[model samples]
Target chain A: MQTIDWIVLIGALLFIVIYGTWKTRNQNKSVKNYLKADDSNWFAIGLSVMATQASAITFLSTPGQAFHDGMSFVQFYFGQPIAIVIICLVFIPIYHRLNVYTAYEYLESRFDQKTRTLTACLFLIQRGLAAGITIFAPAIILSAVLGWPLVWLNIIIGVLVIIYTVSGGTKAVSVTQKQQMAVMMGGMAVAFTILIYALPKDINFSNAMSIAGAGGKLNVLDFSFDLENRYTFWSGIIGGTFLALSYFGTDQSQVQRYLSGKSLRESQLGLIMNGFLKVPMQFFILLVGVMVFVFYQFNASPLNFSPVATQAAYESEYADEYHKLEKELELNFEEKKLLAMEYGLASENERAGLKEQIVLADQKEGDLRNQGKEILKKANDKLEIKDRVEINDKDYVFIHFVLNHLPRGIIGLILAMALSAAMSSTASELNALSTTTTIDLYKRNVQDKSEDHYVKMSKWFTLLWGVMAILFASVADLFDNLIQLVNIIGSIFYGNVLGIFLLAFFVRFVRSNAVFIAALITQVVVIYGWWVDWMPYLWLNLFGAVLVIILASILQIFLSKDSN
Target chain B: MSPETNEKNGPKIELTWQKVFTWMLVANLIYVLIFYLIMKTFN
Candidate 1:
């Protein structure tokens, strides 16, 4: 990055930290103020909620996902609006009525301490692990593509979050998120505009989209009932709904965002805002990725986007074979470019003919790219690094565009956009993790503590979780994709927690013992199901929630009869 | 019995539960149509 880029990146980050700390410097003297920030308005709460969920992974890998697969992934959020509606009607009122610090505290009132503690522990495990992955997601990609040290990247992101979050607590997370969201959206808008202008003059937006459609990136919604498909319309609506309900309803990370609202009306309105805006915002981000895909069609792209894998291949004995694939790929790109130009001007019938040619050319290029990956894997196997480097190239696609194509100062702004997203999410996660730990675990176990004492403990716990997240990030490895990995982690545990909350709310007779045992059995079953790939990860949320509700109700009858 | 209207300020429901829900369903329908049109126009 040039001097201008550094100025933009550092300047944006420093502004967030100083602003967050400055805003909430004296407001957090009590547990309620530190943990809930009960004065937050609807807009701050809504932005914080959105910012918490849209991590660096969302900004970085989502476009790559759209580029490689298609826009079908947008269907993944089809359930979220319904989920938010359900939460507004059911979940939000309960938490607000109880005036609880964390979601689990209500479980204690309805069930027993065991059930509440059990659910809180589940959140701690899932969210604690997610906190690390959120930091690692952007750090690993930026480190790989920018040649920055991974450990330092992790530390820089983690420490920035820890400073503000530890200083001002929940209020810190809320206030800074508004600024971070501004930087994030501003940077993305700038990137999108520049990308459009960067495209070939003849290829207007419509033509560019046609090229993308011919390549199959515009298949936004698939109504297929196939269970094996992960992002079908049904799966997105049903499975995505359950996931969103569990996440926003039961999970303290999201619940805490709105729990800070100045009034019940404000909190509900904030969530409603999220429900209204989340899908379109995601669609816009995915469109940016689709546009990047269109940009690459006219330009030369790497055979594989992963820099480390390609570097390893270049240094190994397979270098000659890799170069051969590169030459073949270049020739293939030239052919496809010509075919695309023909496609741009063709009539309806003629366009169909050109699309077939374009798809065929695209398939051949994909085959060559796969062949290149195989060679790179073989090359890496010979190296001392082994599996330390990722061979899959999807995560690297968007960052590759940013570094290679975006202008100097804008590159820094985009990088700031990425780091801002990282900080916003990690701060929320760390803040949530610490809040749950203090209220549900520490304060519950060690009673009669002063308000000041608990506030101090909250800060210390935030620091500890921040350190743990950084440590986990430093050692974290890439899975299929960073975004999916975080969701999969949430899916594994979220369904069970959501189930417990559902039983507490809707089924009044299901007592603590039955629900607790049912949750244990369901967790084991869900983990086993995920292990064997029972369904796509999204459905796990539905599966776990349904299982717990069913098992708990049945167990409640048996246990109640026994007690009588 | 609706959770949304069970408030002391309950009788003055500004955005009624029914209306808000209808809006959600309607918005979703519009989004689906727009997405389908984008697909048809390009493909």
Candidate 2:
């Protein structure tokens, strides 16, 4: 990175940290003010909600996902708008009625303390782990790409979040997120514009779309009934809706974002803003990825995008095999470039013949890339990398492009955008984690504590969770696939909690014991199912949610019958 | 409910928010239509 890039990146980050701490340090004299921030406007809430959800992984891996897979991922968010509308109608008013600090507090109101505490503990476990991964995910990637030390990257990101979040609590989180959101979107927009300008002279935006579409990168929606297919319209609208409901409605991280609003109307409007904007925001990011895909078609791209993996492969026994594949890929790139030019310049009738050749070349290229990936995998096994990272080349695609192609200062802005995403999400996670710890667990148990005392405790809890997340991030590399493991852990617990909330909201007949017992059983069954490979992991969310509701109702009926 | 969440934000619902949602949903549907067209056009 150049001097200008450093200035842009550091300048953006420092502004967020300092501004957040400066603004909210004095406003948090009471528990409500510190944890609730009852004066936040809709715009702040909206931006904060969006920022919390868009972790660094979303910014980094998504474009890479599009580069390899196409635009089918956008379908995953199709249910979100509908999800937002539903939350506004059902979840918002109820949360307001209870006037609770944590989402778990609502569970305590409708059910019993056991159920509430159980659910809060589940959140602490899942989100506590996720907060760590949120920092670790980006730090690892940035460290790999920039050749910076991984531990320092983790500490820097974690500490930046801890400063504001610990200083100002929930209000601090909301305050900084607005600036973070601005930096993220502004940086992305600038990157997208510059990317378009960098494409070949022959390719306008129209022709680029044609190229991308023909490459199977623009298959936006599939209305298929195939259960095996991941990103179909049905799965997104059905599965995505439920997921969003659990996330935006019940998860305190999101609920807290909107709950800080000045009024019920402000909160509802903020979530509605997210609903309207979230899908398009994802579409834009994926489009940026698709554009990167288009750029690679005209330029030379490496067989494997991960520099570490490629370097490892070169040093290992597979070095000869890797180089041979690269030679073949280079030759194929030359051939495909010529074919693309012909297809672009050809008359209508001549285009069909050129397209067939282009398709054949594209297939050969894919085959060769697969061969490269296989070699990288084989090389990984033999390498002495104690913290052996998997060689998923797709994850490195866009960052690789930015480092190689984007102008120096713009590069800094984009990195700033990514780390800003990291800090934004970590801040929210830390804030919410601390709030749940304080209000749901600590305050509920402790009687007659002063408001000032709890406020002080909230700050301490924020600092505690922040330190834990950083510690987890530091040792995260010691275990392989901790990221995927964390995601799976989240899925296991999320469904049961969502189920508990659903029963609370909808099923009046089910009381505390039924829910408490049913929740314990459902968790055991869900984890056992995952262990036994009973179904796909994604289904666990629906399965666990549905199971708890069914079991709780059945248990409730049985209890009432016995009483009679 | 606290006065913070009472009649102030009740009854007199913002017509603009309702309209805004409908408009946003309409725009979303339009986005789907445009995306489908692009797929077909370039396919």
Candidate 3:
């Protein structure tokens, strides 16, 4: 980044922070206000909810996902719209009627205090770790791009979130989220347009899409019944629905968003809006990735997208061998690019002839790239690599492209967007984590306090969690797919949490001890099942929910019969 | 029936619009399931 870019980046971020603090200055100084924001309206609540879910990972990793894997990842969201509808119809009204602060608060009323605390603890653990990962995702990317120390990047990102979130609480998060969502969506649109325009002149939007299609990047749906397959139609609808329900309905990070709505109707509307728009929004984001993939096909792309890895390779004794491989890869890319252009212009029969050539070329390129990765890995092994030795995945591709290709001012804007996404998500997670801790544990178990005291504690808790997130972010290394790691974390706990909620709501005759014990057994079983690889992670949510309800009901009968 | 009883028993309709809408929503959801399955088969 140039001096101008640095100035623009810092200026944009400073303006956002100052603007958020000023807007939420008059937020009521009470626990209710700090945690729930007294039930706001459709626009504020809806946008804040969306912003919380749309993390920096969504922007940073999704385009890279598209660039490498193509659009099939979108199939995972096919069930989200329906899941939102389910939450709206069943989850919203019940939660609103209960008048609960945290989702676990109702668990106590429905079952026992033990059940409530257990569920709340589950959320705190899962979300606390997730908060760290969310911060880590963008911090690692920015560190790689700027050559900054990961520790400093983590602290800078974590502290900025802590400042506003600790001061303005939920209201501050909601207000700034509204602005952040606007900026994120607008930035994405601008980035997509630029990507399309940057493609070769003869390859218009349609031709670019055709190139992507030919490369198998446009396979958005897979109907295979195989249990091993991750993103199939069946898994997406069944498993994805359960995951979404667990996420939006039970998780405090999401439940807290809707719990702040002014009326039951407004909250329902906000959730419905999410259900309606989320899939299409995800589709648009993935489409941007597809275009980026197309952009690279016509242009020369690096053997490895991670600059850090490339730099390390250059420094190693394998420099000559790596340069030779790079030259060979470039030659292959030029060859494939010509074949693709010919296929694009040729008639049906001639195109068929060129198609095989293109496929052969693509395979050759893939083999060369894999070989390059092997060489890089070997070099790192020999050098006594201490950290950051993993092969960089497709997630960093889009960010690298932006940093290297985009112009000065626009580069800064994109960077600011990445920071905004990271902060928006981190703020919401910290805010929710604090709300769950303070409400579910501290206020309920530790001691009762005045509203003012609770409010003060909430702020303190937010700051503490923010620091914890920074610490976690500093130590964590980049995963092959950072976004999938986030989802996998959610999958581990969501089923068990959702199961506890399901037992509470529907199993009226089940007593507290039975349900609580069943929940404990169910959680252990779910985690064990995941560890042993009995089923894919997506199915874990359904397994957890069903196991709890079944076990709780049977336990209720047994315990009651025993008392007789 | 007495006058009070008659007044209390106003409109003994079997199904109201709200009930119909609820059923409609369920039917629509069922349709979505079928549509998804079909798309899976063909696409």
Candidate 4:
């Protein structure tokens, strides 16, 4: 990045932190104002909800996900609209009626304190770790591509979030997210524009999409019933719905966003807005990745995008093999580029013939890349650092494109976009984590505390969680895909949490003891299922939720019979 | 703040809950159709 780029990146981040803290100064006189924000309108609330979910992982990893995996990842959010509608109609009203500070507080009123505590602890554990990953996700990629130290990158993001979040509390998080979201969306729009404009002149939008489609990158929906297929339509709508329900409806970070609304209608409308905008936002980001994939068809792309991985291989005994693969990749690229150029001008039959060649060439390239990964793994072992570097290059695709292709000023803006996303999400997580800690645990257990005292405690907890997230990010390792890893972690716990809330809302007859016991059993089973790879992670949400409900009902009947 | 109204403190939309939900579902269906069309057209 140039000096101008650095200026833009640092300037944008500083503005968000300073603006947020300044705007929300003197606002946290009480616990409600500190943690609930207490005055957000529908629009602000809507953006805050959107920003919280679209973490740095969403920005940094998602396009890479789409570039490699195709647009099928979008199906993961297919259930969100339905989830939002349900939450608007069911969850919002209850949360508003009770005037609870945290989502878990309502659990105490409906079930026993144990059930509430159990659910809140589950959220804290998952979201707390997720907070670290959100920081680590962008930090790792930016560091890899920019040569920035990973630990410093993690600390920079964590501390940036902490400054504003700890200062202004929940209101600060909500307020600053509006600006961060603007930076994120605006930066992405600019990047997409540059990518499209930079595509070959003959390859208009339609032709570009055709090239992508021929390579099978445009497969947005899979209607297959296969559970093994990670993103089938059925899994998206069903499993995705359960995941969204738990996340938006039951998760404190999201619940707190809407709960800060000026009124129930405001919160409901804000969620409805998120529901409408989310899928398309994701679809557009994936489309950008598809465009990047198309750009690489005529241009050179690395056999492995990870610089660290590629370097390690070059420095090892497998260096000759790696050099041979590079030669093969160059030759392969020339042939594919020629065919792709011809494809833009081809007639129907010719297009079909060229499409086959293009697909075959793509497959050959993929095979070569996989071979490169195997060699890199072998080389890593020689270096005594086996498994330290991620073999998967999916997360590195977009940032590699940005650093190598984008203009200097724009590169900084994109970097700022990444930092903005990281800050927006990490702020919400720390804010919500602290809120749950303060309201559901500390304040609940230690009563008769002054309003100012609780507010102070909330800030301290926010700082503590902020530090914890930074420490976790420093030690974090690469998962299969950073975005999917975050979701998998959530799914492991969300199902049981959502099930508890579902039981509380609908199954009025089931007492607290029944749910408490069933939840424990269901949690163990869910973790075991995830451990054994019973199904895809998305389905874990359904499995855990259903298991909890069924077990709780049966246990309730058994308990009643024993009492009788 | 009964179930039907739930403390209606903002500007009222004329659409009922049933209608709003129908619209959201219909929008989803429309998006899915567009996705399928893209898949089919590209294939």
Candidate 5:
């Protein structure tokens, strides 16, 4: 990036941090202030909730996802609005009534202490690991593009987040998040507008979309009930809804957001706002990707988009073979582009005649690209199985375009947006993790401490989790679809967690032992079901909830009869 | 305030019809505009 862009990027980031710290400087000194912002209003809590969920993975990988996979991924959010309604009606009132710091606190009130501790431990494990992955995912990309060491990049991002988060706590997270969301959305909008203007003259927006549609990149909805297809409308609605419910309702990272509201109504409004906004925001991000896909059709894209892989291939023995294939692919793209343009301009009868020929040429080009991928894979296998492997799927395409094609200052802005997403998400996770650990585990089990002591311990826990996240980020591999990976990790535990909460809320007759044992069995069975591939990941949430309720009810009846 | 008084206040009702309707309208309008833009630009 140019000096001007670097200056702009650094200035924007520094301003956000300084602004957040300044705004929250006089925040009260108590556990309530640190964890829940002492019950703030709708706007602060609302924006923080949104920013926490919109991680670096969403900004970095989403556009690339759209570029490769098309817009069907938006289906994954179809169930979110419905899930929001459910939370508002059931989850919010109960949480407010209990006056708990974490969602698991309610589990303790309704069921046994064991159930509460188990649920909290599950959250810590899943969220703690996820915090690390969130930091690691973007750090890897920034390292690759800027040639910085991954370890240093991880520490830089993680430590910056830790400083503000440990100092200002929840108030800092909420305040900084408001600005982060604005910058993230504005940067993305600018990037999308620039991408459209950069397209070729003949390809106006509509025509470009038509080309994308013809190439099957505009398939946004699928009603198929297939278990294996990850993003079908059914999976999104059913599986996605359960996942969203568990996430927004039971997850402490989200619970803590609403808990900071001055009233229950404000928190409900904030969530309802999220429920309504999330789907469309995702749709727009994915649309930019579809446009990127069309842009690449007119331009000559690389056989592989990963620079590391591409560089390794170029330096290997297969360099000459790869070069020859690249030249042929370039010619093929030129011929296909001409055919597509002719087809676009043709009259009805003329179009009918040319359609088959155009499709045939397109198929041939696709096959040639596949052939080139195979060559790269083989060469990579020979060079070093671990280091030289090329696993380029669809998610790397947009980033590759941005780093190579966009102007200097815009590049820096995009990079800052990515870092902002990572830092915001990681900071929220660390904050939530610390709150759960201190309140659910330490305060409850250890010697009762004063408010000041608990507050100090919270900061120490935040620092510890932040360091742990940096360590995780430095070591993990590049996940192809990071958003999906994070959700999948959540699904494995969310079902059981949500199940425990369900039992606590509705099944009053069941004793603590029954519910606890039922949860353990449900978790094991759900893990087994997922391991054996009996159902897709989304169904696991539903399974976990239902299994715990049924098993707990039965166990309660049987155990009661035996005691009598 | 005592815990009983806090409970009697019943979580402080802020759910005004005007506010709810305003948010609903704003949210729907935003969705419509997004769809219009996508259809206009990409269709």
Candidate 6:
């Protein structure tokens, strides 16, 4: 990175921190102001929700996902709009009417105190672990790419978020997210434009589309009922809806985004905005990645996108084997490039023959890349620090593009954008964690506490969670599989919680005890399911919700029989 | 702030919500269609 890059990166980050802290600095820091600071317009709520959900991974890894796997990942969001509408219709009005700080608080009203506390603890366990990865996901990726130490990067992201978040609490999170969204989207848009212009002048957008089509990169929908497939249209709608419902309706991070709205209507409208725009936003990001794939098609791409992995491969005894694979990759890329250009220029009829040839060439390239990955893995066996090196290169592709391809200031801006995404989400998680802890646990158990005392405690708790998150991120490498566990942590708990909420909302007769016991059983079953690899982790959300609800109903009937 | 609408603010929230929801579902249908179109055109 050049001097201009450093200036842009540091300048943008500092501006967000100072702006967020400055903007909410004047709030009186009452409990409402500190934890549930309302008065966000719909647009602000929309952006906050979007920013909170889109961690650095969304920016860093999603394009890579598209680059390799194409746009079928967009199907993962098909359930989003449906989830949003359901939340607006049922979840928002009740939360508004009851005036709760966190989603778990509603359980106490509908069920008993134990159920609420149980759900709150489940949330703390899942989200607290996830908050660590919210920082570490980007830090590890950025550290590897930039050769920066991971500890410093983790602390930098965690502390930057803590500064503004602890300064003003919920309002600070909502306020800073607007600017964060702007930077993320603006940086992506500018990068996309530059990428398009970087393509060969003869290849117009239509011809570029043709090239992508020939490479089988433009696929957007898969309606198959294959349970083995993760992103088919059916799984996306049925399973995705369950997970999103758990996320938006029951998860406090997202729930808090709309809860900060100025009014019930504002909150509803805010969610509506998210429902409508989430898919298109994801589609646009995936489109940028497809363009990156196109960019690489014309340019010479490495056998592996991760430099450290490639370096390790070179350093190992397998350097000769790696070099041979690289040579083959070069030959294959040259052939694909020429074939791609011809396919781009080919007419409608000519494209079929060219597309078939290109697909075969693409398959050969993939086979070589697989061989390269095998060599990289074998090379990694010699590394002293095995966990830090990512053998798979999916997360590195987009950043690799930004670093080697983009001009100076924009690189910094894009890096800043990714870091800001990390900060934006971490701030929201800390804010929500602090709020749930203060309201659901502390205040609920220790009654008669003054709002001032609770508010003070909330601020301290935010700082505490933020520090823990940084600590987790710093030591993340110790647990080689921690990232994978954290990724599924939310879905594991989400199913039971969503079921409890759905019972509360719909099943009037299932009382607190039955629902509470059913939730506990469902949780144990869900954990066992995850342990056994019962199905894909995301489907656990659907399975858990259904299991808990059915168990609760059956228990309710049996308990009623006993009571009679 | 029209005077007639101002008087209806008490119950104003949900009158248009169902309509909005219906339209929103329609929009999702359109999204599916557009995605299908992309697949059909490109793949």
Candidate 5 matches the true fold with a TM-score of 0.89
- What is the number of residue pairs that collide in model 2? 0
Model 6, span A349-383: residue lDDT tens = 88888888899988998999899898877766666
lDDT (C-alpha) at residue A443 in model 6: 89
Provide the DockQ value for model 2: 0.35
What is the DockQ score, from 0 to 1, of model 4? 0.51
lDDT tens per residue, model 4, A1-564? 899999999999999899998999987788887888667778888899999999877887788888888999999899999888888888889999999988899999999899999999999999998889889888988898889999999999999899989999988999899999999999899989999898888888888888888888999988899977888889889878877888899989899999999877788888988988898899998988898998898789998999988987888889899999999999999999999888876776789889989999999998999899999878766653425677788878888999999998999899999999988889989999999999889998999979999989998999999999999888775444455677788888988999999998889899999999999999999989988999978778888999999999999999999999
Candidate 6 colliding pairs: none
Error of 6 at A291 (Å): 0.3
So what's the TM-score on candidate 1? 0.95
Off by over 4 Å in 4: A383-387, A477-489, A527-539, B1-11
Error of 5 at A449 (Å): 1.9
Each candidate's fnat: 0.51, 0.38, 0.00, 0.53, 0.13, 0.47
Considering the true interface contacts (CA pairs under 8 Å between chains A and B), give the fraction that model 3 also has.
0.00
lDDT of each: 0.88, 0.88, 0.79, 0.88, 0.79, 0.88
Native-vs-model 4 lDDT?
A: 0.88
Q: Compared with the true structure, what per-residue lDDT tens digits does model 1 show for residues A267-373?
A: 88788889888889999899999999888888999999989888878888989999999999999999998998778767778898889899999999989999998
TM-score (0 to 1) of chain B, per candidate?
Answer: 0.61, 0.54, 0.54, 0.62, 0.68, 0.57
Report the number of clashing residue pairs per model.
Answer: 0, 0, 3, 0, 0, 0
Q: Candidates 1 and 6: which is better by TM-score? A: 6
Candidate 6 residue A562 Cα shift, in angstroms, is: 2.2
How good is chain A of candidate 5, measured by TM-score?
A: 0.93
Best-to-worst ranking by DockQ: 4, 1, 6, 2, 5, 3
Worst 10 residues of 1 chain A by lDDT: A475-484
Report the C-alpha displacement of residue A225, candidate 2, in angstroms.
1.9
Task: List the lowest-lDDT window of 10 residues for candidate 2 chain B.
Answer: B1-10
Q: Name the runs in model 2 displaced over 4 angstroms.
A: A346-349, A383-387, B1-25
Worst 10 residues of 3 chain A by lDDT: A384-393
